[model samples]
Target: MEVAQGLCGRGALVTGAGKGIGRAVAVALNRAGARVTALSQTKADLDSLEQECPGIQTLCVDLGDWEATEATLNTVGAVYLLVNNAAVALLQPFLEVTKEAFDRSFDVNLRAALHVSQIVARQMIARGVPGAIVNVSSQASQRALQDHTVYCATKCALDMLTKTMALELGPHQIRVNSVNPTVVMTDMGRLNWTEPQKVAAMTSRIPLGKFAEVDDVVNSILFLLSNQSAMTTGAMLPVDGGFLAC
Candidate 1:
């Protein structure tokens, strides 16, 4: 019996690789022997990622910048796996949300992901490379939270985009899916959820009795990208500590 060659020699791309879930995914993929390229708006974060995983490449660009993102993607070589993990959340009451904030949220969370998919999927098709794409969405996409009106909307739209992309790209052997996670215990997440009342309220709702860790979500992303899930596409798997089920 031979061991399966996993991600070795494959070209992988991960957005929002500057921090949190994105950073974890990039590191895991690199360790699995993929030629990983991490994209982030912050050069410092990219530098840190490179230090953490020596041979991985890094790209500095704001996904919200439409033209620049497209141009940057065009320059990237063939990519076999893509993880659209970049997103921005502006939590405000429905009526208090300004048009600018709403648009900006969509710019990064939804529009940018769509554009990235188009460019990368095109490259895969032209190269005849069977690939996988995982979009990092939030549990907010399915259940609304107070002060998360705009953020919720964008994630919901991203899930739909995942389905549509999967439908269209399936014929070409390109699988598209998404992972919806609850509050992940990243550095920023800890600061934001520090209020005891907030923590208790959120945790009580999860059947698992806790929030997610970065590696938890990263493991799901890697599973979706690997051949282990070869027949799974257009699926939205939850890494939410059973929040959705509860």
Candidate 2:
């Protein structure tokens, strides 16, 4: 089979790559001919991705655990692309939020990306290789929705982190960008927006009149990681079906 050459001979690490947008991104990268290292907290998901793509490495590690994340990156080489797609969402009112919940959201959604980027950036810098880091964010970062304060806050922070990292790492030839998507049709989405009435109501708000698919998010990440976007950095690309524009 002749694979695409955009990322051929390149190595990539995609966090939370067991399912949904993460899984789709991993498959996209693999189809583009990159050697992918898929990381997720679920052993079964990782095993599944490994089965789908023989010789692909799968690591089961909770990104919330900083030490374990650091250890996992040590074994990998200088990567051509790093997708910080691991995240946790909390849909609760500010008054209902607990300190533990807040911390967990920030830790997993923001701090984990920081830790992984640091390790990956170090390797890239040391090896003097040009690379890209694509952070998976959300439309919630820019818009305030009911019962999504915590999730929105974390994504907002992630956007800032992307810019700061881009500034600091640019000289080292490391590009940092973000992909913000609206409600994606994933397991999580089904749990939150499965009702026909609810889906219709939400779709009405989006200018595009529908929620985004997992592939919509994956394709954007792939574009940012590829040389086609060599000049792009620190950009928060929205795959939100005009949700933010409305």
Candidate 3:
């Protein structure tokens, strides 16, 4: 009998893979021997990633468009690991939030994740392969943040969806979970939290007294996708620096 090589020889898919946490996850998976299919809208980012990690397949698609996303999924082949990391944050105060902003936020963050999971999970079932899925959630999902009204709602819904997916997909040997991270110092993160007062306030709340590096979140994602988390399902692992604990 052939021994299972875990991620090796398996196919992996990551969305929003052009940069930030998604980029990190895609690179890590490829290094671990998985054939990676990276999806993102930015061509330059994808091209740069390909140069950095040879042999990674790239797909440029906007997951926010429902019809386009469905069409894109048809082109995807079998994948054993799926990371729903693509998300958009349109920060607006609750009172001033527009319909378009709300729809776009939910469409990409919540709707896209569900659609991709459905497509990937179906492929796993058809192949009779045990698989793992990790949704890149946010700490805002649990704790409310000012001006993040819509973003918070979508993530909160995603968290609940993860639990339901785990419940139903568990019978098929597919584990589903999410990682809720605090402020990760990616390009976008730094832009929002660059002010000294904002940074200090945020850090003071976290027990670690520092924001997450992209790799910090990436390592957590890798753990959830690997066999090391074989017995874990319906779990929401926090990659926060103890912010929620405070």
Candidate 4:
């Protein structure tokens, strides 16, 4: 019996690869032998990942910029995998949310994914290659939480986008899916969950009794990107610790 090959010889692009889950996913893919390209708006973060994972490529670009994203897509070959992990979370009351906050949230969380998918999927179709797209959504898409009006709205839109893209791209042998996780213990989560009481409060909601780890989400993304899930598409798998189930 032969071992299955890693994502070797494949080209993968992951957005928001500066840190957190995106960075974890990029490293995981790189270790699995994929020629990974990580994109981030912060050069330092990109550099750090590139340094940590030798031979991995880094691209510093704001996905919110439509023209730049379009141009970047042109340089990549038939994308074997694309992880739309770039997102901005603006937590504010519905009435207190500013227009700028709302627009920026939508731009990064929804519009950017749309722009990149259009460009990458076109190349995939033209090359007659099969690929997978994993959108890093959140549990907020299915449930409401306090002070998450704008953030929830954006993720909800992303969920819809994932579904529609899966439907449309399926004919072209492109699989589109989403991985929704609960509060991940990343830098952002640490900042937001710093208060002991707040941490306790949120932890109580998760049946798993703890916040999600970065590797938890990364594993799910890799699974979706692999051939094991070849027949899977249009699926929104929750990596959340039973957060939505409760």
Against the true structure, whose TM-score is highest? 1
Q: RMSD of each candidate?
A: 1.8, 1.9, 2.5, 1.9
Instruction: Report the lDDT of model 3 for residue 23.
Output: 93
The true-versus-predicted C-alpha distance at residue 234 of model 1, in Å, is: 0.3
Better model by lDDT, 2 or 3? 3
Spell out the clash pairs found in candidate 1: none
> TM-scores for all candidates?
0.97, 0.95, 0.96, 0.95
Candidate 2 Cα outliers beyond 4 Å, as residue runs: 1-5
lDDT of 3 by residue, 1-246 (tens): 012238887899999999899998998889888899999999999999999998899999999888888898888778999999999989999999999999899999999999999999998998898999999999999999989999999999999999999999999999999999999989988898879998998899899999999988988888888888899999999989998887
lDDT of 4 by residue, 121-238 (tens): 8888888888899999999999998999989988988999999999999998899999999999898887878898988888798898899988889888888888878888999999
Whole-model lDDT per candidate:
0.92, 0.88, 0.91, 0.88
Question: For residues 1-246, could you state the per-residue lDDT of candidate 2 as single tens digits?
Answer: 222335777999999999888988888888888889999999999888888988688889999998888888788765878999998877788899999889999999999999999998988888888999999999999999889999999999999999999999999988999999999988877787878998898889898899888878877888888878888899999998898898
How far is 172's C-alpha from truth in model 4 (Å)?
1.2
Inter-residue clash pairs, candidate 3: none
TM-score of 2: 0.95
Name the candidate, 1 or 2, with the larger lDDT value.
1
